[model samples]
Target: MLDMQRRKAMQKLALLGGGMALFPTLDAQAKMLEKDVPKWDEEYDAIVVGSGYAGTAAMLSMMDRGLKNVLMIDKMQYMGGNSSISGGSYAMSRTSIQKENGVMDDPEMHIKDTLKSGHNLNNPEMVRIMAYEGLDAFNWLVENGVKWKLFSRSGGHSAPRNHSVGVGSYITRPLQEQIIKRGGQQRTRIIMDELVYNDKGIVMGMKVREKYEFKFDRTFDENDNKTGKVKYYRANAGVIIATGGWAADPKVRQIFNPALTPDMPTTNHYGATGYTIEKLIKDDIDLIDMQYIQIMHVTSADEDSFGFGFRTITGGYSYGMMINPKTGRRFINEIADRRICSDAIFAMNEKGKNHPLLIMDVNGAKTVEIDALQRGIEAGAVYQFETLDEMITKFNVNKEAFLDELKKYNAYVKTGKDPEFGRTFFKYKDEYITIEKPPFFVTRPGPKIHHCMGGVRTTVDCEVFNKTGKIVEGLYACGEVTGGRHGYNRLGSNSVVDCIVFGRRAGFAIAERYQKMVRS
Candidate 1:
């Protein structure tokens, strides 16, 4: 039986002192065995290697473009990957939602804000494409059954442009349904093992393992373990790599940023490893901006991972202000870029030996979803106090200093000038931006590893480039797998648009290439 052979193969690999270093031998072995092509057990018109927003978008776009036999796969048992639990906020411009909400925004402003947030290191063309085509991508999702509503503009955006579906599953689940309804096939627990390319260095297919069981103990070297049965799946058109970043793997994170030790908590799932990106690198693919791993400034100090606690941040950071419990003074600009806020919090926590408190009044708490806020309160991630005296007594803060700071902040909000930290406020009603209302809500948030802003380099069309700066034929990448979209830092809510925009573009490009090949 196939199962017996797979077990024997795994045992053989273990006997060979473990296949822990299987991928490191890729370069030398690939050259030596250049003539030996894999025997493919299955074939598809196009293959998408991930089930997150990017992969789902790619598959749907391919199907929309008349590619029927498209197949999508994920290494994990569950679909959507990291995107399933993400914040699910999409940043866009010129949307009807923004206009209805009296938010005057445009693609040009979105592009400018993105560049400023990334510190001008992002690929201008790629940013432009995402900003311009983002509306189309949003419309596509709506047409495909994603019911979106306007969320507040996240950090680093100048206008209220973030739209959401409550959570990432809302967006991913609907699109997945569309894929199944259209007869597109999706398989989970299928891990990509090796890239199968021809002699001319053109991708033909990929060697993968079906029913792959992820080992949590060896989180860093997940693919190094021999668990699943290896088989080849040929892609007639190409392989689209949508596998996400390596924020969950501490060892991999340390390779790019030594400061990101294992002690740091990450919002990513255990499956968000860099094996696919590492494999691409071994194959001489060009990887850029690997050093720019982003840390979320507003993760729950109470929760171990991503939870309802994030809703506290959605309300607190945007509508309220962060104050040091030890000093009872606002340290940095609360609504500044994520990098700025996170770094300041890191410093404050180290100095005070305590977590900073995010304080929001009733008006501010109104921004968060009611259900999520209630869940956060029940989960012990958020605390509510009817009076400032109650909060002061609970945190043992210098009550006078805290009260004085709030007064100053409210005055700045009135004048539209944050002289202390220069935090840009939302251009909405006073009650929404001011923190003067009673019945305060507070959350203790700390920085957690959130997104990796580095991976394989890609053209605007999502065509990947080799180390030699040449396009890899039949090989495309999108989502967190391909870098250079966000330069040093990625703005919040931009990841959704980035993934969908490029994923759709890559899907269309690959489908068009396939059609041209058929004609030829």
Candidate 2:
């Protein structure tokens, strides 16, 4: 590995290993935060909850601005959060990355595309801020050692607006290393179970607990295996909840968006249980866009039954194409908005017993690279099939019907047009000139819980607000934890930008608030 690559790898291991910044352990770590534990909870200058893009961004900005009392806390050992597991792609306007590549992008055009992608259901002011500040935030990533490259995505973005890691890993980790260097406290395996309010009804800090969703191996005798109790965690200060959305926790989804069953697939991280969001709602923290869920139509590497959706694309032009099991026919244009894509995937399962093929050809295959694939090779996107026939046999697609479809698709390609779906030639770069690529692979795209657009609603400055629009004193929010930015749907790779731009704003807001409050 090159020097930069080595540094990045070590940093990632640190995040996974839960040690110091850039993979180093401090001579003196911050009391484990767990030490304070369920007894004698203390305070800090700033307390960040949910170490996803937003929380980590806030942590860095605060520490960089020289806040000594800042603490970066989260439930996970690694700081990447869902952003880490994500495609690591983001849409930013006026970015040096874009201008350097001569993409001819502007905030206005980006706003238009974003709104169009969201089907005109976005909050105008928030969208405007997001677009305007995105480029600067992205540049910040590059400056802080984040390696972002260009990729076109499922969004109808004009200029391949997806900026992702040039390497396979997440782009957020390097930014996280910067935060740690600045002396922000990072604690993994911590979960914020409840919000803490001060004497004046001010949303002060939060009560954190250790938590783990994975069931423990049972040690039982004369009985069936028992699930081990999960861990608990806590954090107190001005708790900025950046814990992400409800996609993974189907139970939470079914509870809130009852129309959709939890059994529906999601590409979201397992930790994306939305425990904080649910409790906050119970606290009467009114929310917006709860019905929104970002689902994908990508294949899962684990199971041969191909019904899930949500494959993270590493590069190239790709989206999703679901097939009809009965007739082996294509259904739904692949490039729809995320929410629509998700809803469509689930609808396919609901209609076809949750069995459908998410199809992409040779060029498409090259583009679909989810980083976790290598690290989790035994279970990443890995599949077992030598030929297309083997895949059909293993996956149980209608044999003759699929063969007929492929024959027709191949013939249509020779004519230089996809008559079935007007995918438009140029739209798909390096188009599927042929589907005869050996190991024409396919897998189950599990419905993943990617992100939660709803959380603590905030103004442009990232200040948390009540139903009356009054700022909750000392409380601020950023990232997937905050809502009302993208309305019914989010543009591809926009949330990373959201976390950075708004996270800085929240950090600044907190810093300014702390300085003034302390002085006065």
Candidate 3:
């Protein structure tokens, strides 16, 4: 039924400004008029939206401080936005990695990596707070259930302080479980349409509507079918926007970035839309670095799927090797910093007309399907072909050129060497592997521009800022919505670290605000 309505809505969508615009059709307008929006007259001490690492941390922290009236909200039926998809890596200081290895890393270096990575575009204050306070947050996550194992730092970083929570940010399940166990109120699959405003220009509550939610069936067919009424959550205490970046918003991406205009490569959740953020900006909310976007280097075997098990970040090997189609050869080292890798991928895609070529083993081809494919195949994220020749044909590469590329790669595989690019000897741990197996897999890589490094400008304590960089009263934001942590590109797993450490701080901070306001 919901699918029917969505299809109808799509049909009723009109083409305007060269894009499919979903303005209210006459039917929608009439339906909206027929129904009264839910009145959110009750004010809560605190309200936190989004269930990712940041949201969960904030929610849990608020409860810890006896802010029982708080409510946690999310648009997805399931909690944990990008946190669920994340690899759960955390950047910290004075940790076992540093202590055991005697690696001398301080907040200065972390701040430097963030600042230099962002090209100094990040907020210095927020960056400083993040770097200095990261160790505690990293510890908090491990205490909560986020397990840590040593993952070779993929991008450019000074030390081995990079720690992953075994599952990355996907531990949302456990975090949510903890939050629920604490008796915190959780409302999932409800879209936060808008923030309620008071006459004094302070935040009130929020207008929410139960929209599409994630329905997990082994069948895997779930959606937002409930044409529910809009509700409200009063923010008499504080409102925290934990909603993540806008990777799922296609139109917005097209408008802001031309390279991701079509089929380039991006790994974002289906629900990371910045709808609330857009509305907030329209309502005069301040933002930081809205223009600085981050792109990732993705390698998939086919046009349909994205390759995972990042050999650069993880030592996992897949069927094919990544290449720069323009040079018709491997270019920058895959283990190079993410910024360089992203630049190389975008340049190659733009130059090669978006058809990246891959070379893999015929035996490795077998690894391309089934459990090896995992969620990719079930989610239509990848496509498989029988032979390297067939895979080349699908990608529209020069057959002879593709064969020649494979010949050279195979020679290197037999010899334990890649002389052309020196990729095998790259610093990242996974560069040395042999894909001499059958059923070589090929996939189209998509850059995950999900976590916006730029968001509502905020202080380290997580206070939302105005355009003049002044703190907005009665409001705070953290997680992806409050950016300025990662300078340009966030190191893998670092964002989750920032979210939890800072999210806990935001919770305590907001709870204190509520207490002060109550006292006053």
Note the Cα lDDT for every prediction shown.
Answer: 0.84, 0.60, 0.62
For model 2, where is the 10-residue window of minimal lDDT? 216-225
Which residue runs of candidate 3 sit more than 4 Å off their true CA positions?
Answer: 1-42, 97-106, 166-170, 211-226, 262-265, 299-322, 325-328, 350-448
Better of 1 and 2 by lDDT: 1
On lDDT, the candidate that comes out on top is: 1
**Which candidate's TM-score is highest?**
1
The digit string of per-residue lDDT tens for model 2 on 1-520 reads: 3335434533653564421212111122111223333543556777888777788778777766667777776665556667776666778756666676566777898888776665444667788888888777777777878876545544466566777774324566776777667766777766565565645656656555554333321111101212233332223235566677766665666555555565455555556665666566655564665655555444452543222223432221243245666567666555555555556666666643655565545544555554433332355454534577776766777888787877776676567566666653333444544466664545444445455555567878888776566777767878887877775467777877787888888877777777776788
Give TM per candidate. Answer: 0.92, 0.76, 0.73
Question: In terms of TM-score, which candidate is stronger, 2 or 3?
Answer: 2
Off by over 4 Å in 2: 1-41, 99-102, 166-169, 209-237, 299-322, 350-354, 359-364, 368-420, 427-439, 444-446
Number of residue pairs clashing in candidate 2, backbone atoms closer than 3 angstroms, sequence gap of 3 or more or interchain: 37
- After the best TM-score superposition of candidate 1, give how far the Cα of residue 198 lies from its true spot, in angstroms: 0.7
Cα lDDT of model 3 by residue, 1-520, tens digit: 6336434433443221211322211111111110243565556788898888888899888888888877888877677877777667677777876787666878888777766665554566666777777777776666776666554444656566667654544467767777778777888777776666565556666777766454422122122234456666678787888888875565555555555554444566667664666666755666655544566654443332124523321332223466544445665555455666666666667644574444444444433334435545445444455665566556665567545666777677667676776654322233434455555544455444545666777777888876555676767888887766675456655687678878988899999988898899
User: For candidate 1, what is the TM-score?
Assistant: 0.92
